[model samples]
Target: MSFDSANLERAAAWLAQIARQRLTARAGQLVETDLGAFDYYEDGSWLAHLLRRHQPSGEEFGILMLALSPHICPHLLDTVIAEVRPEGGELPELGGVRAAGHRAMLPTGETAQFFFSGMNMSRRFDIEGMFLADHWFARDRILWLESVREGEPLMSGRLIVNPEIIEELVTGKIGRPAFSMDFPAEHIETAMDWDDLVLNPLTRAQIREIEHWVKHNDTLMDDWGMRKRVKPGYRALFYGPPGTGKTLTAMLLGKHTGKDVFRVDLSRVVSKYIGETEKNLSRLFDKAENKNWILFFDEADALFSKRTDVRDAHDKYANQEVAYLLQRIEGYNGLVILASNQRANIDDAFVRRLQAIIPFPMPQQEERYEIWRRTFPEQIALAGDVDWRQIAARHELTGANILNVTHFCAIEALAKQTREVDLRCLEEAIKREYVKEGRVM
Candidate 1:
């Protein structure tokens, strides 16, 4: 559903009512108030959908609104502050902190406690329960309380709503995170379909198994009552030479399954500083934990290679990073694909844990022929002299090689002001590919 301003307005009103009541109570007025009177789950809003899906308790719902208040309506609380202390001073009881960029005060955990529990010891303890490590609030990554200074009350921490949640509520869609230091994976997708992929029957069958896991893993784990016995998520190792279908297969899997594919850049993921690598990986995995994303770690051998004997601190830490990676990937609840040029490059620890190890070897002659025939679009015509079967047999080019040749030929055809690609152009393109790869014609 689209952003519903009316529902947000209603929620803001409810928050304002509660805030005013709390402020009035602090001023020696015992005003009767029923916090449950407002509809926390209004029909048709993104927040409402989340509320319905999670079904958080009344206290939990109150905390969520308090966390979301600044983003939606900052002035609402500022006005409450003005009313309570018109002389303009900090209201410690209302609990908030000033941000350099944010003009108004942002709520803290203490704010939520003050708004909901109002100094009642029992109620405050319940609010504290919601922020515990295992609570859905933190586990689902919906919201959390920021860390406080040493020895300070935990309630003093600033309340933080997940940025994705805020984006979804405001724009009615969750924004895909961009590639950065924190999130080093880039989103990848393919316009090509399964029909365009060329693989041997055995390899194709292995891929199909991965597809089955993606489609029915929840059933296997939950519906079949195997959750206790089996581990969460699927792990696969895609080993192959360059230009084989390893990466393309990953993209196609996501395309066919309707899931996002994120290729982790190992250069960015492996930090030189001790413990930094795990932190970088943790940021990536934490964001992806509930996203059901297919994480493609291309050239994964750089990170997942066999460990060496610890001769130094660096060696010890490197091995530790690999162990940490193994534990994290095993615990992930979605598909994790580690692609490398060779299977032997990966550590045995990762291999033994893999559910599937599919190889993308160099395409055989028949597969190469199919690839050549399928590379060109229907808009481009092949000259009568062009022979795909002969070329496919002679060159032994990969699917990617054929595609590169097709692209070169197509561009040449367009340059020559014609819709047709001739045998000469095709031969020249193939020669270029061979030259680029330092291979003999």
Candidate 2:
């Protein structure tokens, strides 16, 4: 409820600037001036909350979302930046990041027509300035970003601010702000089936289907007159044997798209408390909706397993979890992957929404042989008499299994002061891997 002398000074200075701007300005009004157009939203909310011991209201909230919108309409950012001219205080800058990169500044009066646009906007590249502004005077502040992009002929303007990108933008030097979360930059969508990753024609075809939906450009599928997304985008179900590349495929896709992939920890996501599962799923979906990340749920048969008759309370709750999961999967705007070894275990209701379904079955003999051969480094010293066919005939390992066995074999060969993996050592690893699976070695 009380602020230090410095805090009082900031709040005073900020409030003074808010009074200077007309917060009710409509979208048609061109923002060409000072902090007067921007109301102090976020900082004000925190102040009011601290004072009243409750949540802030109006322009006090949604500051982060407003600052991040990609195409802000009617020059809202332009107005905000004009107002933010070198206030007495400046924010801290991490190494190599400019002042603008850290936060954005804008005027308070720039809402109205851009209300919805600003509410969800986020993540525009270089930040320009940052200032706290309020929308409607319900006692709160909103953080605003000030930046611009090159515009096309539709408006005959050089500046373009996107309102669509509202979610990932953060203001101020605060650590771990929701808008500052880093989306992972790797995934399986980048797999070049024929050129980079070795795969059979069928696998390549399936990859093409996924790629088509992913908006792969080289194929020109969009301009080629296809009216719809090949598979569209729904949470997909990938099932088969492990090491058959289910995880690899997911990672490849994420990597290709320059998005992060997050594998949900079902243990943390599913809870015994009522509505806990829905809450957890909602949080993940909300995060993924705005952030650049692919949600992957591996070994998901436990979470997404078929629902049985609700005779018991446990069964009823389990069914509720399934229903919640289905809704989340359908609502997610980006790609989601659920992988399980037991395809039969997934409920039929859940299965119907998959945009693309691909099996990662255990490799056939030919594929297995190719996997084994590729598993080793090209320059490894070979006895020249290595029989891949014989090895393939003898080993029942999947690509992942083969990769493990070969990696171990290579290390063992090195330990033995030999450049090439010997049949004896290779057999030892293969036997160990097979025994783990309860197969006769």
Candidate 3:
């Protein structure tokens, strides 16, 4: 007593009727909406599905349209619909809500029997009741209720979906809307030239490498075998003193790659309750599929600390958490950057996973000079007598401190009613920095 044939026949007969009624409507009104287009797409069943979702008075009005499918009697579907119209523009429940198919509601929540001709497949996180497709936005993604693997042949063979391909489609280091379906206005990105933007103060070569990777990571991943292989990505560790452009480099990389750079908000990921942190991270990855994102964990050492000799439950659970994180990170398909001021705090196992450990050493004398010469824009006028070289040499501060001193000098020089920065004003800025750092400059 296979219901498969009976169910499909009932559903097909239902859809053929819909096509005939739509034809009677004034031209150019049909096929105007996602629902309309979907109803008309290969079969009108999709519209039937939507109607079932809303469950309005005349589910049969939409159900009748399904008759248009080649296999159904279109004329009979139209006849049934014409016979049931309420004269006073009234709405009522159509009889025979039941079909000879699967025990599914017709989107009407009316316990209407639905025949599913196609197979539906989805994964659950066993413990967490989350959908794998939750990682995608509905507008940008096209989700098929049934598996297309057994369906008609395509330009490429039947588009059989496997976990490998879906996972590839779901994970990214940087991303723009899962292959460019119209995204929301809020998600749309505004373009900026990382190189031409004057406000950024990162080094040319380092910035260029980040940019090149952003622009050509497809080639890199393919060459490195990360595309098809199950390997943890070669990590790139960024180490430096605070406020010296490490964060800026990461953000610029996201801008270059056409995706959002998310600073993994630690508050959201870390929890006081045991095993909660791992679960939180799992949800984050589930929601981040294929949107080539730059995930920045600013202070990575909190999670990547060295393993300890276990004596208590706390110690064992902590080690388990680390192990779980390593597994998830290895499987992650996007760009991963961990930034920290104290590199020594990160465990060797974590360090070994890194592909590039770029040390952001404090700027040298010449680099510091460029930092000064370029820091003040041409919009602001300075006296020709002001010496940038003297400032860079005398300050001997980190690049960030130099920027601060330059900022103060600009304010002070302007207030003195002079366009040119005076030696005295610059000296005052240097003195303040010396006091803050407790240096004998």
Candidate 4:
């Protein structure tokens, strides 16, 4: 996937040739250019591999090259356009706009039309087909036409290539995107493995079933020809008490199945303005649709809660948001996991649509004992009198609480200049956890 300047150079040359020929033809002159002689498909470079796989038409290749030329050869289009119009006047047929801080002319949908179809309005439809919603470029989120002002022609929008795709073409890999208002989801990972997770047999079995869907649902739907009958994506509900390994289980699921897990930030997702919630979620789902990513909607009740009777305008729009979310999640092609403290918080409509609802109850005494035994770091030592069994039997602490207590004990031991966490330290740490939870020891 290394960047190959030669491929980009060849593409730029081809596009430049097309621009010259089209401009000449439009200027009351006949131009015969054998564009078919161009050979851009011969190599092991990233662009060549992409061209070979997608096999775009000559005109479609020109559009892609034009979109990419901004990054690789910034002055390519500017030079060609300047040659065509030496008087330094704008050409409306070659649609483009000057971007802030960029000296070169950025291509727009109209620019693509001019390059490919020239003055032939009939052939413009053929160029339009390349930007259709179902097209590979759009579906894969590689490139698209940006939104334009209301009443403006769609072709007037800027032709945008995805930054990730550009990075892949320039660099060897695509880095994880940063979490922001636009994305509203964070890429989450864990070094812990499945063996580290302690779940009940029922929950474990249910999780295994989800893993099956992640690993082989493609085969069942495509190879087995069940796509027409079965839904496109897998929807699962993970509900239980906080700190009961809900999030950890999700991270572990992604780890075992080799899929990235993204936790949607509800605070960023739910907006006060009308239609904003749907807009935010739409951006999230649109970016995630083609990526086989596991969307972990933690504390999902804020967005997917039970809808209320329409008592006010707020209530009606809230219900509409829920409806929109349902449609979006159901249509998503990958796994969607909604994690909440309780199943009752989610709407019954969502519950009915869920393929699996797995509960992560608080750990039992035995599980808590195991958690306590494994919670402490390997470098830390437990005092001889620190009876973990009795501690687990007496105090009910979730895995997260156990880790918190262990962290406190480790810090206390370090403060006292000791290598060991004594039973008294453990007791004090456990008491602090209870106090934080408003529970009496």
Best prediction by TM-score: 4
Best by lDDT: 1
User: How does model 1 score by TM-score?
Assistant: 0.90
lDDT of 1 by residue, 104-195 (tens): 98999888878788777777788888999899898888889999989998888999998988888778787789999989999999888999
lDDT tens digits, residue span 15-111, model 3: 4344334433343233221223222222323333334454432332332222122122324433544554424242222211223562221222110
lDDT by residue (358-434, candidate 2, tens digit) is: 77777778887888777788756766556888889877778878878878877877788778866777788888888
* Decreasing TM-score order of the candidates: 4, 1, 2, 3
RMSD of 1: 2.8
Q: Write the per-residue lDDT of candidate 4 for residues 1-441, one digit (tens) a residue.
A: 346777777778888888888876754233445546347656676687777878777777788888888888899888887887678875787788898899789999998888777666677877888899999888778789999999999999888998877887788576776899889999999999887778888999999999998999989998999999998899999999889998998899899898999999999989999999999999999878768999999999998899999999999999999999999999999999999998999999999999999999988989998888887888788879888899889999889999899888888778888888788888898999899999998
Candidate 3 error regions (>4 Å): 1-114, 117-210, 219-226, 230-234, 383-385, 438-440
Task: Name the lDDT of candidate 3.
Answer: 0.52
Better of 1 and 2 by lDDT: 1
How close is every model to the real structure, measured as TM-score?
Answer: 0.90, 0.60, 0.57, 0.92
Q: List the residue pairs that clash in candidate 1.
A: none
**Alpha-carbon deviation at 345 in model 3, angstroms:** 1.7
86, model 1: CA deviation in Å?
3.2
